[model samples]
Target: MSQTETNRRLITELQSRGLRLLDESAGAPSRRGGAGPSDHKAVQINGQTVMVPVHSRSAAVSPFEAGASGANGAVQLTRDGAHVGDIRFPEAPRFYGLQTLDGVPYWKIAQLHGTDVLATTVLQTCVRYGRRDTSCQFCAIGESLAAGRTINRKLPEHLAEVARAAVRMDGVRHMVMTTGTPNFTDRGAALLCESAFAVRAAVDIPIQAQCEPPDDPVWFDRLKAAGVDSLGMHLEAVTPEVRARIMPGKAEADVEQYMAAFADAVAVFGRGQVSTYILAGLGDSASAILETSERLIALGVYPFVVPFVPVGGTPLAEHPPPDAAFMRSILQPLGRMLAEAGLRARDIKAGCGRCGACSSLSTYED
Candidate 1:
């Protein structure tokens, strides 16, 4: 197979089946702190960075596993003991070991996503998490806070300190700051604006700020003025029924509100700079996802369609991940749609879509 085809196939497999570590002593840098599926490990295969679930039940029985024996810091990827390819585990970032003046670990404030983009949830507490009927079934935003792996709320000053360290020590090119919705009309936009300002003041890096649509559309301009290069308003499920079933409270910000918000955000951040995350497996059919992608693309919103990984400790922990075939069916056409519309991830200034590590859509953006 061609290298590109091989990579596409491998990414589909890894994201769907996860990866098993045959040797725990292989010295791979496992995830130590973060929200949602804290057991993932970053691995590079065929020049693409992917987060593979290593501690999930599916991974324990996954056909794919990494063998310890290798050269040049590379390991062998195998399926049922048959060689597939060579994979390399990324080393932990230097910033992970550093601490703030108050003695808080830098890693607890922000963690590396994909290869070099630093990511953090600014507000760990969510208004919806208090009630099972309202919480997003796939969310584990509070898991890290509960485990004491991260602070409940990251102060702007501390975030600035960490951003400076991460950029200086690890060559982090960009940053993604997402926040759990607080019980404010601004829906965490105000805090994101403050945090974005601090990070930009400390480093020259581009940043993406994610939150639900605020009560006021003017916050989009405020975020842009605060040095936020991109904006993300995630609609994890495209259909209202699926959304209501999967993320009850979040679904209250109906499709119409999100559409309005996306329009407002795009006006400030510009077309490709605004994006939304669409998780493809919570019972949204490929047709529904594609139709929604069309609408988002029309509004200049880059649809970052990703496979649903059942996060541990969440209500959906036992829910199976989308099948590899199912994901490819969605991504292949969705990638083509993005390419034709000139809404490629590379065109995104900075954000999850631009990072494009969690999904294999970028590979199919031919």
Candidate 2:
């Protein structure tokens, strides 16, 4: 295979099966349980940093394992006991060591994602998270909060402080501010606005704010005015049946509602600036995912389709991740669709898709 295809295949398999670290010291500090990309550590392979699951059940028995660290922390990757290639872990960000004047640690407010993107959940508690019946089966939004690794609510100013420090100390390129849906008509848009406004005022960092579609479409304009460079309204599942089965409460908004919101959002954020998260293995057929992605691309929405990683401590913790073949079936075609529509993830100002670390879809976008 060509180099790009080789890297794409390797990343897809690693994300699906997870990576087992044979030498504990070989890897950098990984995100344990948090809002985005939990149970993963950022691994740079062939100059691309992608989040690889290292703490999931599948990881413990993964055929792909990393051996002892070499110079500059590069480790040998072996698949089925055969050496594959070398990968390196991103070192912990310097901002992780600082704290707010009130004694809140900076790391809790915003943690490093992949190599340089700073990420955090502005509101750690979700209205639906407390109940299994209402929550997304794959979510672990409350795990970090319950474990005391992060606070319940990150005040706007506090988030700003950390964002500024992260930029200055670690050269953080962009910021991702997601929220647990709040119990309001605006969902969590108001909180994200406040947080994004503060961060923008504090620094010149590009920001992407993610939340459920607000009750009013005007909030999209408000979000753009607040310095949110990009917008994400995630449709974790596409079809009605899968939406209700996987994320019952969020499904109430429905795919139709999200489509309307995406149109409104695209008007404000421009093409490729508005995006959505699509989990590929959540009972949605590969054709269903590609069909949805085609619609999204037509509407200027980037469908960031990622293989679902079953995070520990959630309802789907033991659920099997989508195998590499299934993911390849979805991503390979979706990447072409994205290219045809001129909706490249790299063109996205900021967000999960722009980061392109959670999934190997970006690798196939060429």
Candidate 3:
């Protein structure tokens, strides 16, 4: 097959496989059944168990290195024309072996993203984490809590110590800090600013923070002034119907509110420096996602679209991912728009938009 034909085929299979994976993970009380304890990160996809990353803040263990068996899983992967492993295991972060003066665990506060980026949720609990009906169905922020893997809130000192350790010890090149929604008026953005400033006091690594829009748009300036280099405000699913069903509590805040937030954020962060995650496979139409992408690009915002990776214990684990054809259909065209808008990912200072490795949108953008 020609190169284009090969990529097209690969994209299709990835979507189908991702969708099939989600379906098997949902409906069960947990993604793993009859599998006993199972190391907390083993998940089954259509009876074929696979090891997936489990986020934690207190311990320094590679959930990937401890993954359960999946010899039956597919392994043919296409990356830069080389067929490689379907999912390579992420190495343990180099900083995991350290701790703070108070004996606080370094690995417990921050974890590695991809290979070089250190990422963490500044606060582990969300106002909605306690409410099932209003919860963002796919989120597992509370899962680690039940497992005793993190504290309810991460102190600024904890973030600072861990941030410095990740960069100094692990050679981390970038950092990202996010937080759960607070009942407070600023939607958790201000807390992110606080965390960023704390980290900035010790290190010079580029940092990105994600949060919902604040009632006061000026907090965007505060976040930037505090040394946050980029921003992410995820619009997980675009259409109102899917959002209402998938992220009920967050959906209560409408797209217009998010758009206004993005607009103000772009003014401070500038062009590609601001981003929003548009997750695929939550049952939104491909056209709707592309429509949202076009709108975001017009506003000079990078719409970083990623295929939804269902958490094993989440409510929608059984929901299938959108097929590969669906992903490319939206991404290829949208990638063109990103190029036309001169909103390239390379321009983003930090976070997922710059990483572009998690989603195949970067593939299409190529």
Candidate lDDT values, in order:
0.86, 0.91, 0.68
Residue 143 of model 2 has an lDDT of: 90
| Per-residue lDDT of candidate 1, residues 1-366 (tens digit) | 897887898888798888889775554356633443256778898778877878767888899999884768889999988998898877778999999888999888988887888999999989999798999888888777888888988999999999998889889999999999996599999999999999899889999999999999999999999999999999999888999999999998899889988998888889889998898789999999999899999999999988887777789889888889999999999989999989998888787888887888888897
lDDT (Cα, tens digit) per residue for candidate 3, span 1-366: 776545444543443342112222221122221111111233322222223323221112211122222464433333334533343233466677787788767766776655567778787778886677988887878766567655567788788888888888768888888888886588888789888999999889899998887779999999999999999888899999999999888998899888888888889988888899887889888889888888888888899887665555678655555656677777788878888788887778898777664565655555
TM-score for candidate 2, please give it: 0.98
Measured by TM-score, how close is model 1 to the native structure? 0.97
- Ranking under TM-score, best-scoring first? 2, 1, 3
TM-scores for all predictions: 0.97, 0.98, 0.80
Model 3 pairs in collision: 19-321, 26-317, 26-318, 57-108, 58-108
Off by over 4 Å in 2: 25-27
Query: Can you rank all candidates by lDDT, best first?
Result: 2, 1, 3
For TM-score, the strongest prediction is 2
